[model samples]
Target: MKALILVGGFGTRLRPLTLSVPKPLVDFANKPMILHQIEALKDVGVTEVVLAINYQPEVKASHSQISILQLRLCLLKKASFYFLQVMLNFLKEFETKLGIKITCSQETEPLGTAGPLALARDQLIDGSGDPFFVLNSDVISEYPFEELIQFHKSHGGEGTIMVTKVDEPSKYGVVVMEEETGKVERFVEKPKMFVGNKINAGIYLLNPSVLDRIQLRPTSIEKEVFPQIAADQRLFAMVLPGFWMDIGQPRDYITGLRLYLTSLRKKSPSKLSTGSHIVGNVLVHESAVIGEGCLLGPDVAIGPGCVVECGVRLSRCTVMRGVRIKKHACISNSIIGWHSTVGQWARVENMTILGEDVHVCDEIYSNGGVVLPHKEIKSSILKPEIVM
Candidate 1:
C-alpha cells in the first residue's frame, strides 16, 4: 500500500519552534511528529510513503571546480536552504531506517490540499487499482490504518474520510453521513446552523479515480472535491475509534500530548514512567536524567538528554531534547524547547512556550509567554504574550 502526507509549507501556526526546525521534524513525545504517521503506515504494510511538500530548497547553481571554502560561504549565505537541505537529509535517513520507499512530491507553488493528489497521481496509481491514504501532517491519533483500509474496501467508494465527533461542530466542516450505511450525504463547512457533530479527521483513503476530480491547480479536497464526491454518492465516512487532535498550534499540541499519554497508559502502562516522584502518566527518555526530590507529570514527556535538578516540579509539559532545569524550578502547562535552560527557582506555567536555546534567569516567572529562539528572559511575564 501507499500513503501520501500533505506536509504543506512552513508551519506558521507553530512558530518559533517551526522557525528553527521543520514542523514534521519537530519532536513530539520524544520523536519527530511525522515519524508517528510514517511508523503507523509502515506497521500497516505501507511500502511507499510520499510527502507532498510545498517548499523546495533553492540552492544556487554550483560553478564547476569551485573550492570547498566557496561552497561553505554559499551555504552560510543561504542559511534557510542549508536548513532545508539538512531536513531532507534526515528524511533520507528515515527511508533507510524504516526500510520504506519515501518520495518527495515538491510543488512549484502553494497547491492547496487537493492539487497535490493530482500532481502525485502517477506515484499513487501503480496499476494495482489499490487505494492510497492521504493525511494532513499535523493530526495525531491512534491511526487505525488497517481498520480504515478494511472499511474503505468494504464500501467500494471513491473516497472514505475518517471522521471524529467534536463538541463544537460550527467551528469545523461537519460530515453528514448515513448512520447505517456510512455514506456521506454532504459536507457543511463551519455551518451557521446546527449540523452533525462529526467532522473530518484529516485522514482519507481514496481510490485512484478520485484524482480525476481534482485539477492540477490550487484546490481544496474538503471544500471542493469532497462535496462533488458526496453529491455523487461515492463518499463515505468512518468514525475514528480513538482520540484525535490537530496539533498545529501550541495549545492543541499540549492537549494532544495529554490525550496521547492517557491512551498510552491504557494500552501500554509499562511504557509510562513510575516512581515516587512521578505523579501521573509521564514519559522520560532513557537518556533523560531526573533528579531526586522532584515531582513530575500528571502528563509530561521529557525528551532525550534532558536534565532536571532536585526540588523541581513539572506538570503537563514537554521538555525537549538537551534541556536543563535547575533546582527549585516549577514548570507546568508549558513546552520547553530544545536545549533551553531554566535557572534555579524559576516558575513557568500556562502554556508558556520557550523556543530553542532560550534561557530563563533565576527566580524568573513566566506565564503564557511564547519566547522565540535564542533569547534570554531576565524578568517575569505576568500575562500571555509573545516574546520575540
Candidate 2:
C-alpha cells in the first residue's frame, strides 16, 4: 500500500521555530516530525510515500552551473528555505534507510485538504484498485494501521476515518458512528452543542474511487467531502486505542514529547537511556556526551551530539542535537532546540522554548521565554515573552 502526507502551509502556530524551518522538518525525539508518520506507515506494509507540499524554493542570483552542483534553498514568502532543502534531501536517506520510495508534489496555489488527493491522483490511483492512507503531518500516535486495514476490509466501506476519544469534542470535528455497524452517520465540526466525543484523528484509509468526489480546487475533506461519503453510507469509523496527540503549538508539542518518550519506555526499554541512577523515561542518543554528576530524567531526550557538563539537571525537557548545557545548569518542562547552548549556572524552566543556535549566557535565568534562532539571552526572563 501507499500513503500520502500533507506537509503544506506556513506553520504560523509554531512560529520562530517554523520561521527558521518547515514544520515537517522540526525535530521530535531526535527525528524529523514527518518521519514518525512515514515510519508508522512503513510498519503496516506501506511501500511508498507521497509528500504533498506547497512551499517553493527559489535559486540564488549569483546562480551558476556551480549552483546546480550544490543544493541551496532560498526564501519562501521571505522565510528561510534552507530547512526546506534539508527536508527534500533527507528523503533520499529515508528511502534507503526505510526501504520505501518517496515522491514529492508541489502545488502551484493553495489547495485544501482534499485537493492534494486530486492533484496527485495519478500517483494515488491505478489498476491495482487498492486503498491508500492519508495522514496529517501534525498528528502523532502509536499507529494501529494494521487493525484499521482489517476493520475496513471487514466493514467493506469505501473509506475508514480513524477516530479518537477526547475529553472535549466540540473543539474538533465530532464524528458520530453507529454503535453496532461502525458506520459513520454525520460530522459536527466545532459544534456549538455537544454532539459526540469521538473526533477525527486526522488519519484515513480511502479507496481510490473516493477521490472522484473531490475537485481540483480548495476543498476540505472534513467540511465538504466526508459528509458526502457519510451520506452515501460508505464511510466507516475505527476508534484506535492508546494515545493520539496533535502536536501543533508549543505547549502541545512539549506534551507530545513526554507522551512519546513514555510510550517508548513501555514498548522498548532499551530505546531509552539506561545505566544506574537514571531518573525517569529518557532517550539519550548514543553519540550524545553526558558529563558525570548530571541528573537527567522523568521525560528527557538528549539528541545525537548533545553535550552536557557535570552537575546539570534536566527534567521534562528535550535537548536537541548539538546543544551544549554547561555545568550547574537546570532545565525543566522546556525544549532546547538544535545547536543551542546554555551557559554555566543558567537555569531554564517553565515551558521555555529555545530555537536553533540560541545562546544563554552565564547565570541567566529564563522562564516561559520563546527565544528565536541565533538570539543571545544574557539576563533573566521571569515572564513569558518572545525574543526575536
Which one is best on TM-score?
Answer: 1
Stretches of candidate 2 above 4 Å error? 55-75, 78-83
Specify the highest-lDDT model's number: 1
Question: Can you tell me which runs of candidate 1 are displaced by over 4 Å?
Answer: 55-80
Pairs that clash in candidate 2: none
lDDT of 1 at 18: 83
Residue 242, candidate 1: how far off, in angstroms? 1.0
Query: Compared with the true structure, what per-residue lDDT tens digits does model 2 show for residues 272-292?
Result: 887764797888999999999
